[model samples]
Target: MSWRPQYRSSKFRHVYGKAATKENCFDGVPITRGVQDNNFCAVNPRFLAVVTECAGGGAFLVLSVHHTGKVDPHHPRVSGHRGNVLDVKWNPFDDYCIASCSEDATVKVWEIPPHGLLKNMTVALKELQGHSRRVGLIEWHPTAKNILFSTAYDYKVMIWNLDCPEQVIKNPVRTISHHTDVVLSMSFNVDASLMATTCKDRKIRLLEPRSGTLLQEANCKTHKASKVLILDNVNKLLTSGTSRWNDRQIALWDLDDLSVPLLEENLDGSSGFLFPFYDPDTHMLYLAGKGDGNIRYYEISSEKPYIHYLTEYRSNLPQKGMGVMPKRGLDVSSCEVFRFYKLVTIKALIEPLSMIVPRRSESYQEDIYPMTAGNKAALTADEWLTGIDRGPVLMSLKPGHPTGESDGECEKDQAYIRDRLIAKNGGKTDSNGVAGNGGTTVSNGQDFLLCSPPKTENELRVKFYKQQDEIRRLVDLLHQRDVRIKQLELEINNMKNSQQNSLEHF
Candidate 1:
């Protein structure tokens, strides 16, 4: 989770305090303490593992339990890079593994417990050396283990297979070169099938994952000084930063045709760079800036092709935390909001019956002798099958008829009446009882048999009951799996322990 304070209030001061003391000096210069740029940090689902950038040169891997936010500071700090750490990411599946990239043009993977000095510390398990220039970004493959991708200032992107330690680090699975300038940012599509990269050359390139082929390129019309480039997806791209001579604009490009952008809405409010976050789920874009310290949200729609400011978040004080010195008279860089997953308490799923039932009141005849209104309208066949309107619709069905029919007949009749009513009502009713069919009428004095299906409360309860039963069964299975895993871990630990004991005994 991105841990930004609610506001620049004193609350932030209480949460992350200033550096207490300087331990290691870089190049004879005491590394001043202060809040650094709010770069991307990855946190595990269980919140037990946190990978963050350090001020000096390397990244720190802190492991802690979820309940108590106590970090094991002694956990092996992976520190071999010559420059400041740029990014760190944890493997999605394995909580004990992490990948770190730095300005030193190197990407390294570390395994906890095995390589660290402390029994429970973290240590570097492998070093990946390929990029000759500063490594700006590193990301794990979304679906595969032992696979990772990295982008660097060397104008090259490399994909690595970390699974085989014996494999030479210099040999990457695939290497692609296209950008004339430094590759600023890179992202993978929802599936690992495609990859996108943005560069200072005012170009965004999309490549196939299996084969290093350039599929499409979109011109951002951005100047050479653009700070960040991000591919929105396979077709769309986003670039932002201080423009060469114009006010900062967050440009969106369409890959199909690069000559003209589908949309180039300017963000007049921000003086600094705009950090854009595109959510695939809602197709909404969120933009933030360091100059204004305001986070703005925009809805990206193809039809409108305009940016709508949904909301803005601002802080009262300068973002620079205590003891952290701002670089080159600039304010602390705004925290970049990256996407991450968090585990939430699973709530009991309550099946809603209304959704299952089809609405028929809209088709009801307003001119009928007795008209139904509000929630008392009889349910339709669609509603019965879906378990919607189980109570009121079923109860209202009997009022129109003199005798109650058998349960099975009631269900069948309800279905038949609903279909006929839909056909008779011309399937039309307005919000204010305005009939769309010019007139409403009944064929004869024969009592209308409008029977909605029985209430789905029992059915829903039964479903919940079944789900609960399934969950219990899964829990039992998980318990068994956990026991097996523990047993294997214990055996491995014992073997290692016995070996040590033998060495001492000899």
Candidate 2:
């Protein structure tokens, strides 16, 4: 007799994907036609970057997330690459910082301005040159500051320590154990201590990234034909590729023992490459093909049948590539757990699809959202380079949770609302009414009334504008902190150099 239930029970079974309308979609973008297998789009909470087709050296467009709809034809871009931009990744800790790899055999890091680009950006914040051939993949350390990894056609993965003020890392501090062939994809463990990579040679190798030691190697029937793979949260490896019969298949493997797969399943025949995106927080794995319009999601567990099929998000238009938003970037208010930026090459559009868990109440849904990783890094580059391991700082999705950011701003906004209400009403009132010109009455001490919502549409509009202003202020504050960090770094470096010279002279 089977010990498990016939049908699986999960709160996320009812989760559905919601696509934004045309007005909400990013339009008029000549998305890159690069033949690269990597996603050409990258998004953060504040900005979105898309590799665009250019007539000259490679260029990528950066726009404020709010600047949606038809992009301005003359909008500024980061246009310094001598060849096509292959991949772009945002800094896990800093919203304004981003890194890119290109066919020019170099990697560049860029720091976006506070309000986004206003003119063509040719100067890069930091440049790294070591790859003999085109650099194709780049990923920032998950828990470390300014530690980056770049894989190139040279079949080498280089680790970069970018803690300098504003200078080039002439070469990587060192290279990881070299791959026999091109590294197709790369993923790091939670603390970035270990790295898993799938290579062109059709083999999956796990390495202690810092020491460049191959801890485990898997060579089986699945390994021979697999094209893409990633390391997930549960200490398991998930791969998607074609099978012997030319059918698309996915397999799951335990990191400890990769001699045989724990589970393997085959899907329909498709020639396009399948891109596997995993959300460690929700334990959800999404498989999207390059030329398919459907996105299939599955729940991953450590128990039997580790991978459970959730549902598919289908559309009429095929996707050229897709970008996923980080957990901190999601809209917790809407009960959204995941968001994807699908690049439609034929229509030159990037559509956003949000995965939402439906809820009756508008309040925060704690069940769907556990504490997630914040923007702050848990380890510095030096600390990580010295083999220190620490988990990412966790933050609540609830509003005003003070995840490193000051809560005083939120309190000040509440104070402002209270002052406005008090000023509007000459005296105190009750929850039943607000003291207004033949309108409503509000209580004196109450900053806001939950029972009586914004009665008039005009009042609601006022509240909306106030909220927008508050958002802008918060954004500006974040930008100010970014600039301050840069200034402080420069000062610290100068002081260090002066002290070294003084000590030598004495």
Candidate 3:
């Protein structure tokens, strides 16, 4: 059979256009079917790694081999975890060594080859285990490969020394358990001196990596929040996310005094649970919401906050979500675009020879001249007929024709048969009226067709009306709830006043 067209839709063509039409194509190469279930991705100075949760309960790492856009099929495959691998990072100075943390309560160090191998190119160099529960995050020390940090559900963060890979240290160098809930995210400042952890308790804490001393704490009231905390070179801290009261806000904090925010501004719309990204180079913040399916960009400045849309790309599927917007690569000479494709299930034929019939018994009787028949051979006649020596068959199937047929005669015969078949099939012609193999084309001279626009202005008007109605209904409900809350508070105050008068009388 001919190759089935897997991608022929207009959308695919629009995304990946002809090589000549660079403007029509996406900003960069589209990475189809690269990411697994994991939503987190990271890129170092040289390599790009996509960390995905595997189907077998572990994580799969697909890395780009070089700084360029080439992917090596034999990159690496580090396995040996019982849970999802949440995070993976390579040492800034050494690209060959990588650290991965898993929900299996273990962290592993892997030394990957720079090129291909006969076997799997990736191998785990060492495994570190200390957390009692699933590890949430893993980050390498900014300055040294000898140290790494990991936080887990066990309510403690651990630091490890890679100098001794075989031994398991029971106690971490420093442990922070101040958060009342699970630590969902963590990051280290550019200078490895300070580490920040955001927990489910709606608090962001800054701690010294060496001493585990809490330098400062800021309360971010958002429930189920993932905080992106950045420490500027001058020691100023910038934190942004949803508030605990369901307010969408980005707050700036002075590390010296964390009790009061230096600046706070509410975002006009709610940002769904996906974590926001902060670009230090451009001083721009990007936030995406799970419900709206839009990414909003904001500029950071000393004056009043300014936010605008850079561009919006729609998600292809529902429920399936986008992960953190990872830095495509270190080179920013041109804007890069990366597309993700989820896995698809496929069915295939396993057995190919189940329908063939055996040769007739008359042929089997002729074979009795050289083979024993009344001697009762254990092998059946059909098996014997089918079991001709494979060497001769393979040789006969090779190019240049079997020993019995001449090459010239075979070629002539094949041409004659093909012409006869074509004639019998009426010399099937395509839309161009050329007598050739079957193919379809548009009836018109045009090579392609444009998509039809929306039906009518009335339909568009209705859609807009429906959206406005939804917004109005939501506002009315919120106002009613607020009024009820105020009435309840007034009644409770009146009751307290009456109780106080009775106590005074007594």
Candidate 4:
């Protein structure tokens, strides 16, 4: 039987209520300290798993999210890490299982009993210890159940197969050493075929998890470091970091190119790190920064200037840490498109912010509704470790909708110009004869070709100068041709005169 509380519990306070008539707001449960960005707080898709850490204790709580803002007295908690629990993640395939990274330089995998309750702090079922420094980030594979990845201050990324059972350091499935500096954030693509990492060295790299090989890398070219997030469409990546001048900016990059940002937006020069939350179904991106009271959102489309500014959610208090609930956990019936758990340190309160699409119609709009990824493992841990080429079943942005259809017809003159570029400079192919996108292949059987222009301004300038020199040389040759034509005409006239004089003498 499932665990349940016997006695009545006090109702949690709501910052804003319908009867109060002041504003629409609510407060979350009090936390020990502000949450960190490195997977500190995770809410599962089914609203079954909610994990958070306390400021004072090196422990975390697995809250019962079914009853908002209320914790069952009999509910179990997780308390194993020695130092601060920096990050925690709910397994995509298993709601009961969770992985956490800590300042103690260890990653632990914990599972809740099938009966649905842990009465006290417990040790992790599997302990992964390899990092010599604090492990700040932990992420689970989107498609695989037992596969986990962690990043630490040691500038290394380790892939773990929790099914191994043995807690040994020398037997990690794969150890990635591509980053020269500490990796700030990492994420797997929609299908889990490619993994991208943003490091403090101002570089973003894409790696193949199967072989732990570096597929491609892009220089952020900025001093400030931020996290990287893969778009739901799996074709692009959204990055938020400091600009060259030390200003905060968010950029949307095409995964194929990575050299030039498809879109770039500058924001306030605040020192807080900008955390990007992207909703694939709606193509909406929410930017929440540390130490800021406002959450800005934008609409991303395939059109030019791909990112369009939408609106911002503001409050009186700044947030120390923030957590975003999965799409499946959202109250879609109420037209809630996105939900955010904001941790405010001012009054030691956590607040819930819901982004709803205001609709006047009474009918349900499945198009606007978010169809979140279900809790089903496409591949097991053992299968992934053995190099299975399976990918996660990612939902489309506009599922059930037809692609490549236009409502109206336009002539060639009215259509926008499409640019297709190719690099002819010493291009080489891999063993598979794929030369583009640095020989990278997507799980969808599509090849990503690198067709972007020069990345840096210096490179663009050099190309421009070389083109100008070619034009100058071409003009000089044209002038020489004109001079040669004139000289040839004069010589022909002199030869004709000599021939006429010889005929008169005969």
- Tell me the whole-model lDDT of each prediction, alpha carbons only: 0.47, 0.80, 0.48, 0.65
User: Relative to the unseen true structure, what is the C-alpha lDDT of residue 13 in candidate 3, on a scale of 0 to 100?
Assistant: 22
lDDT of 2 at 366: 84
Judging by lDDT, tell me the better candidate of 3 and 4: 4
The positional error of residue 450 in candidate 4, measured at the CA in angstroms, is 56
- Candidate 2 residues lying further than 4 Å off, grouped into runs, are 1-5, 223-232, 403-506
In order of listing, the candidates' clash counts read 11, 5, 4, 4
Q: Estimate each model's TM-score.
A: 0.51, 0.80, 0.52, 0.68
lDDT of 4: 0.65
lDDT by residue (tens digit), candidate 4, 49-125: 33344544467666544334434333456777878778888877665677877888999888764323425665778
Which regions of candidate 1 are displaced past 4 Å? 1-40, 47-57, 63-76, 80-82, 113-122, 222-235, 244-246, 269-271, 317-506
lDDT of 1 by residue, 367-401 (tens): 22121111122433333223332222121111223
Instruction: Give candidate 3 regions above 4 Å deviation.
Output: 1-39, 45-47, 53-55, 65-76, 116-123, 165-171, 221-225, 244-248, 266-271, 289-293, 302-329, 335-506
The model with the greatest lDDT is: 2
TM-score-sorted candidate list, best first = 2, 4, 3, 1
**Model 2 C-alpha lDDT versus the unseen true structure:** 0.80
- Tell me the lDDT of model 2 at 40: 95
- Candidate 1 yields a Cα-based lDDT of 0.47
TM-score of 1: 0.51
